[model samples]
Target: MSRFASTLPIASRAIPNYTTSEAGNPFVDGWYADPDTEIYNGLYWVFPTSSYSYDKQLYLDAFSSPDLVHWTKYPNILTTADISWAVKAVWAPAPISRNGKYYLYFGANDIREDGNMEGGIGVAVSDKPEGPYVDAIGSPLIGEYHNGAQPIDQDVFIDDDGQAYIYYGGHSRANVAKLNEDMISIGTFDDGTQFKEITPENYVEGSQMIKRHGIYYFMWSEGTWTGPDYSVSYAMSDSPTGPFNRLAKILQQDSAVAKGSGHHGVIHIPDTDIWYIVYHRRPLSETDGDHRVLAYDRMYFNDDGTIAPVKMLVKDNFADGQMYSWKTYDGQWTVEDERLTVAETAEAKAMLDTDFADLVFEATASIDYGLGDAGLVFRATNLSTSCDEFQGYYAAITSSDRVVLEKINGGKRTTLGEVDNMIELKTEHLIRVTATGYDIKVFVDDLTYSKISVTERSYSHGATGVGARNTAAKFGHVSVQRP
Candidate 1:
């Protein structure tokens, strides 16, 4: 049984634009939150792949949240442009800070083709958590050890003796190597070898090592990240640098709602001794492709050290009165009752405009009308602008089901990218929009509705609100996220 009480009504919200960059490739459709999290300067930092590109070319991006609701994007900390070997993609960064310096372990690839990862593991260091971090030796660390097929997705563990170990790899298999006291170079083992294959089975990758109650645990993501089989499994051992024994599945796809569930990192809350697992899952929109969303669940260990699987639900104990938390949205403006509403007039719009731009719960709204129709709007500079020429700044959902990234430049509307049906906001709905890339993405809700992008004219710079067309409708659930 779990030691912590499960709570509901925790708030959730999407990270704002300018915090994340969209990938031109649809495979890496959006930002993927890191399973592992680190705390520095009293704030929680999450590292995720910024966009999909060739291996060694993808860079690692960071986001910081004080209360895990309203997140602010820190500048790009590690980029391939900074390293000669990392000219392709830099991904899945697991970070640890020691002796006043921070170490970032991540994967890099040299291949650009789809599904082909000619990658290796590398490390970078920085003095500050949010960094312009530099590579320790400007090269791959695994190259100094064994010449395996390709190693990546590195996780670091510091033992009670202060010895550091790195577990990394993907397609071929996962391996472990010890690091010298500097935490940069590989250290020799008793057998005179610097690296060794930890697990004989090829059933894993994305491995994270953690120590709890005198037992060392090895957890990894199984199956392909983009495919339907993605899941999380684990093993255990007595040593920090393990020859671990297989354990049962900690998380997997048990329901239609949560498929392709894997890529996890674990964190123990200080003082409370509570454990939380940070992982990603393919949302319903993934039927089109694997555009993943971040999720968390409270974790518990049995007396024998096995972990219970997580439950899939819209609400949980993490939901606070101030943060917006919702499992899914249907694209119609909705209230707490989950009923859809429309905004045909200003009075109806006023119902959504709140003093803060944060949502505490999740709901959706839809419009039946076709052309010349508007959906929901939030953080708009001005709501009174003519529908065609509206400016001031807002993230609006359109009848097309595509998020419309609208910005007012010189009182004119500019568009970014029509992000297709990345989100299913309606049944046969005209459009839906979600804020991305300092703009909005628009898509039609129908099965045939594709993705569209729209750029914002200016920043509303305040408030959480909604909008609609001159047609008729109903709306409710003004979800608010408070600090």
Candidate 2:
């Protein structure tokens, strides 16, 4: 049985829908959802960004969620025009309190028409937790020094000695720097105060620094955040600034869910002493770098302060009011050997089927069968009069170690895209297929596989069932809906 077997019913509802604005943009891509949330004035605030343009220009928006599931946006917080040099993206704002004032540090980059490092760290200040945060004088606290390049994704940490340090950088490298007493500017040490750099390079970014039991823990997101490689890694430092040692991976690619987890934040529950890591995952339909959703997992620290490996769902404890229901399947179905299977058969049934729109399907194998195939199907429509004419949407793991979305058109099967070493049978896997018009999105486990265009013969209504080709597979908990 999978570790997440009992926790299968917890579902996350969408908080912030896609929005458009002339001045501010809704987060369409990567955004920070810190797990280590700060509670001020009876509200929990989350600082995130909408990286709309390439120069990485973003607005640090504040959201308050009483229950963590439902969130409301704070209209006024940090805006781009507050700082002059922060022209492009303003992201990952980490705030700390010192001397009765709140210090907000973030990552920013100047507009570069060509590919180059125009990124740096910016700081803002406000008297209250929720604020009209204003940039300090001569903003861009840590910029490309003397015609060098800039640093991005700045996180501020204040140690026990009342000293403050900044950690930032992304795109394979991370750097740490010290801050002056005012908590705005960088303070240089002997080597010009470039604290330390993270190593074992593997696309490390989103650095969040925390201190516990005399150990400085550095957590970061590694791998391509939108691709199959996305995950989280960490390191340890004796002092606030390293010579830090790379520890181990806290999260990684789970073939069962097709998830690439990265760009995380840690939250410690004061009452329970429970630690939670908040991160984002690409939806199953995400083939490239486009859409993503936020998720949270309980985290724990080992005896030595190193983080334990993360599981997709927690099995021991259940959240309050959490319930489970099966996702209905959408596709032609079949049953054999006590196993339910969904497959594409040659039949000129419905040209466009949207009836099975919002559904979840559980794909499992009966008795460990090698080279077995099964998954959820959606956005299906017949393309031609002949039974061979079939084209719609479906993401399935072939018996061949490949996870892909099958776009079938008139007997022609086009594998939209595939992520290798990312699919395993025998264990029950959660599959979510979302279809809107001709746009079809498929996600396995919690990771996205692909988003394909099936406008040619898109299905408006169709029936869904399970079947197996060569091996027997079990299908259950099929639920469908429209979100």
Candidate 3:
């Protein structure tokens, strides 16, 4: 081990609530592949190859998130333009922080610059976690084949003793090596072997390792990359350099949705058991191999410390505010051309699918029928207090051209506040509602209608639906976001 390989510090971080169903998804933007996910400086980061051909894949983009929900993209952090010697195919970046600086280890030039055609891995450095990184050394760190293992899909693993090791592969083989403190070149163990072949049966590429509770878990991708057979499997051992026994499969193609799911990395929340599998998948209906998108799903462990199979879900975006976690509670509502339409129903509600803790929900709506009342329903768990009413706070405009904020529970409606002739009936108005704990505020056309301290505590976290009591309404730009 190197001199600095005794104490790799684990950062103490504020635990945001990443337990939502969306946590079991890849939340990054754009097409990307072969993810190496890490948490640095209290943020979650994913380093992925720009999913394209070798020429188009000459750069890597990094994504960061304060919580898993909101992600910001740092585009082209490192590219061939910055690495003077790099020609093509810069893929699979494994990042680690050292001495207050961040280092990104990556594979470039799928074939060596020389006639050998054996590609190599390279190193880049940057001061910040999300970097405009420059090449640390102007050349390949490993430019030749070793023990039949092609130098691609490199992953870095830091041991409990702080030893940094690298694993890489292709062509049904895998390799590992120790890294010197400079972190730009490979080092050898006391035994003097520069490369160790830990290739298990059915191995293809994408190698990664993590030590949990004194157990060494090794993972890799397998099968053909162009077909649905491409997937992730693992092996576990007692040492970082392993005579690893092949374990069970973890991630694979869900034929009904996506395929070619492979080339993965793992992230374990510091000082906690929470783990997430980061990878990419060929999206549905795409036949091109490079047409892949980054993905993630939470991973768990059994009592025996064995990992459970991944429970994956496709990511949902909040741009339309209708995609992913938002669900419709009641009312015959359908989303068409990003507009939410409420069928001329007699009396019902329409809420988002998520159980929001605190949020601002807004939509521009019109009661086109012009014959009845329309409102916004929020903090509602049950759709019906009676056959025709929902149990929650209701804020609306009456056909009589008045604005009222009321609570509907136990088959009774109690108006907390009302303003006569504040709204024009059957006209388009913006409905905005903010809910935080027991305090509720309602707005009509951006005008404040009610500020009430809700007395009922029966429902704390529930759905926010649109209200159409006796009218046909059309809603556009339905939006929800954290306040």
- What are the candidates' C-alpha RMSDs? 14.9, 14.1, 12.4
> Quick one: how many clashes does candidate 1 have?
81
Model 1 off-target regions past 4 Å?
A: 1-30, 51-57, 110-119, 144-149, 200-202, 287-290, 316-483
| Every model's TM-score | 0.61, 0.57, 0.66
lDDT (Cα, tens digit) per residue for candidate 1, span 1-483: 112111222223232121111110111225464456776655556676553434424577676654453356665688877667775656778889889999888877633224343336778899987787888887777653243524667788888889999887666466788989888888989999877877634455678888888888888877777677777788888876677666666777633234677787775654444576767766543463335556666677777777877654332221222223221112333332233444344223432223223222223445545332344444443444243333334344554544554454434666544343443333324333444435444444442443654554345333334455443443333333321
lDDT values for all models: 0.56, 0.55, 0.73
**How does residue 120 of candidate 1 score in lDDT?**
65
TM-score, candidate number 3: 0.66
Instruction: Tell me which residue pairs clash in candidate 3.
Output: 26-296, 326-353, 327-352, 327-353, 350-465, 350-466, 351-464, 351-465
- Which runs of model 2 end up more than 4 angstroms from their true locations? 1-36, 55-57, 110-119, 145-150, 190-203, 314-483
- TM-score of candidate 1 relative to the true fold: 0.61
Number of the predicted model whose lDDT against the real structure is largest: 3
RMSD of 1: 14.9
Per-residue lDDT of model 2, residues 1-483, tens digit only: 112122121223222221111011111124333323454544445665553444544466666554443355555478777877666667667877777787677777642324365446777888977678898755567666322223665677778887788777765666777788988766887776455555434536778887777778887777775678878877777877676667788887544332667777665544444566666665443465534545566577777667889765311101211211112223454433323443443221211112344333333333135454555555454433343545455566556765566666666767665666455656666655665555556666664554322333345544343334344455544444444
Residue lDDT tens for model 3, 1-483: 112111223454355424322522335556788999887866777898888888878888887765555567788899889988787899899999878889998988887334465347888999997788998988878778888888888888878787889998877789999998878779998898899999988899999888888989889998888888999898888899999889899899864346889998777777778887888887645678888877677788899988888755432323222333234545677655445667766676655444565767676767767566777776665654343545667777777777778777756788877776556645678877777776667777755554333444545665566777777776665555456
Lowest summed lDDT over 10 consecutive residues: which window, candidate 2?
18-27
Residue 119 miss distance in model 1 (angstroms): 5.8
